[model samples]
Target: MSDGKTIILNRIREALRENPAPRPHASHTSSDQEETPRDHTPREWLPKVGERLDEQIDLFARQSEGLKTEFHRCGTMEDARAILSVLVAEGAWKKIATHTTPDTSALLEKNRAEILKTDTGYQIDDLESCDAGITGCECLVAQTGAILVSAPSAGGRALSVLPPHHIIIARTSQMVPDLTAALELAKERYGNKFPSFLSFITGPSRTGDIERILVLGAHGPKRLTVLLLED
Candidate 1:
């Protein structure tokens, strides 16, 4: 093999050694004489999560709560708008940043005076000072309580990660049982080509780096809120 390929392989092996994966099976059984040899890697790696959409959504909410993420379920976009309006009014968030995606952009339209919408008279630097940010998500991975975000769906990676308070506006149809299912959906959506960045966000940014004491918003948003649009 080429030197570059060998080096890459070595790094991968080292990473595997540092954090070993669970053994799929204790031992392999001897194959029957008439049986054909087959690889089960895909099956082993992508085991069935065995959850319906509602079950997955429940699990997602529970896990997100464990991470201090707040959830608001809305039957319609108007309900979602009311929730956001209340949040801003009560929390005293003077300025807000959101992506240009149609869903979020439409929501922002009602409260244009407070929005920091980039390129529509708003700019990137304004987001740093904005009290909160909002964007649409690609999918909600229930198994891990993660919101799958990509550049195309979310508008900009920076808009998702840079704000102190991050809000996700997503529909119930985006729900999936697990990471594997979410990835498969993304594959179908993007085909061979994909966005520059896709992020799996579980909750607010946190760390236990300073003497193991819990810290919120250590590197990113201090709070995360999800507005799930119910059918």
Candidate 2:
């Protein structure tokens, strides 16, 4: 064998002879000890979030700013309605798509734009034509500034993605401190009957692939506005 190949083989043999390094959070299955499941939780590696609600909201706001998401904290439903109205006026939206939810129905009751409810069903072309999509969310993750939306919470998958602008109307009570907490909440809330679709939307769709120039709405909504109402 060549000197280089022999040296490589000798190194491999030496490595095999030495004891392997223990895997992080791995469970040992020796004869004397009982075998336990490996720990998969990554709480230690995640960013720390405050226990207080205000601190969490603040973190979420800061993260959202970095992600270029428009976030508004409304003290009342009326405030949210006013914000929605302003958005409609600014965008000159002639039509909006949404699902049937108490909050959505209340906010869009007197909207100037035509409403397309996707509760039962909707066409892709019609949904795509709408200027904006309005929907409720499952929860807001403060640590990552992510909004969790499921098919049941928001409208069908297309409603949020097809429109040019995506607006989320959620209550402050739905906010969670981190992704782990959000997952736990989902498990506790849904149990075995979880929604068919679950997604984490960090911000408006964007890409910096072409010449390292950031562009929004590359694959999804160009604008993401969160209207957070106090419960």
Candidate 3:
């Protein structure tokens, strides 16, 4: 491996070591008084989030100008199949979802979609070759309109980044109030056994690196579609 690759691997190792598994919470996870979800107006929190999501979508649309974005509510396995059909029909991806379960697997096959099946050791190229990527999310934060993803089952980290488009299948119950709650939940879930990678994706890949010009898909997928299932 090149020196840069070696250094990156070492840094990943260090990060894993530095972030030991989260210790289980003492009282109902974290403190006895968990921060309850707020029942307030949209203006109660950061207004930028709304704009960010809207802008983020617009930015992603620009990145995926030729591609399509679809959002669906998966109420049953059949619903999942239907979504897969649309994704396939649009040729939205060259490959199907990764790191999926048998049920999801069945759905994929039933839909006659091509998928990549691995034990969580797949490389970025495997994902890059694909048209899109999909995985389950740990949680979603409404305040920031982000998804909390952790675990090797999610295919380390590259699965979400390398693909030009991503589809995360999650239930509405995963939605939390804000980032603080997401972090607290993380601290409780793994304690001292945290994985090597944890991602809080608020929106699609973006940057303002080129002469301060905002660019989407500068590093990761230009489009991200979340299929939220009913609780």
Candidate 4:
């Protein structure tokens, strides 16, 4: 492919060697506010960016392999709590569990759901009894539909990996532009105290490793809901 492209470039250069094209002379043609043709208007590329974001979301959905996804926009703590209630109610997640963490307890109320606080570990047996695993996230990227989880709140990598459903509570402000921005945010937030685990979850866990057939919940949750709390 490289050789073919190089040969094509060489031929084009040779063909244009004698009849050199005239380059446009620089001139102060117009002011910064000059009226331009509507068709030639500087591209409203924000729409294209939006389209790309939609495409990424669709790809994540397809790769999710049937893993359910929902986005909740909460403007206040009350709204966030309400969204949490709805998730718990809709999923019928009666036995909610998580590793003991201040953020876990702060985000969840024991009155709303059964909070079974466990030690920091990811044993399959314990996760088997869990209906949902609610944990805190370090950061999220809007560009790629990815979430970063790290630190003592991670509850071992397996807690986020083994459950049938996982609910991640992240502040809306935590979401950045892309993976690069997320990494920069991590660096600023954690300097040298970076957590032991950092997992970037775009969607739910899925695998097409079997006969080229995609399967969801093969090793992790079949559903992943991210609640972006504004408060």
Tens-place lDDT per residue, model 1, 41-160, is: 343555345457777778888888898998877888888888888888877888898767767875675763477765344555787888888988889988778899998777677777
lDDT, candidate 4, equals: 0.67
lDDT of 4 by residue, 1-231 (tens): 478889999999999989978754435354554544442422332222233634544443343333355666556656666777777788787777777665466668534666666564444676678888877787766655677887555566767766688888767556555566678888898899987788888787778998989776777788888766654
Displacement of residue 53 (Cα, Å) in model 1 is 1.8
lDDT of 2: 0.91
For TM-score, candidate 1 versus 2, the one ahead is 2
CA lDDT of 96 in candidate 4?
77
lDDT of 3 by residue, 20-63 (tens): 89655433233436444343333554433333434543333332
TM-score of each: 0.78, 0.83, 0.64, 0.63
Q: Residues 115-219, candidate 2: write the lDDT tens digits.
A: 898999998888989999999999999999999999999987889889999999999899999999989988998999998889999999999999999999898
Model 2 stretches astray by more than 4 angstroms: 1-40
Better of 2 and 3 by TM-score: 2
Clashes of each: 0, 0, 12, 0
Ranking of candidates on TM-score, top first? 2, 1, 3, 4
Global Cα RMSD, each model: 5.8, 8.6, 11.9, 10.5
Per the 3 Å backbone cut-off, how many clashing residue pairs does candidate 1 have?
Answer: 0
Residue 35, model 3: Cα distance from true site in angstroms: 21
Winner of 3 and 4 under TM-score: 3
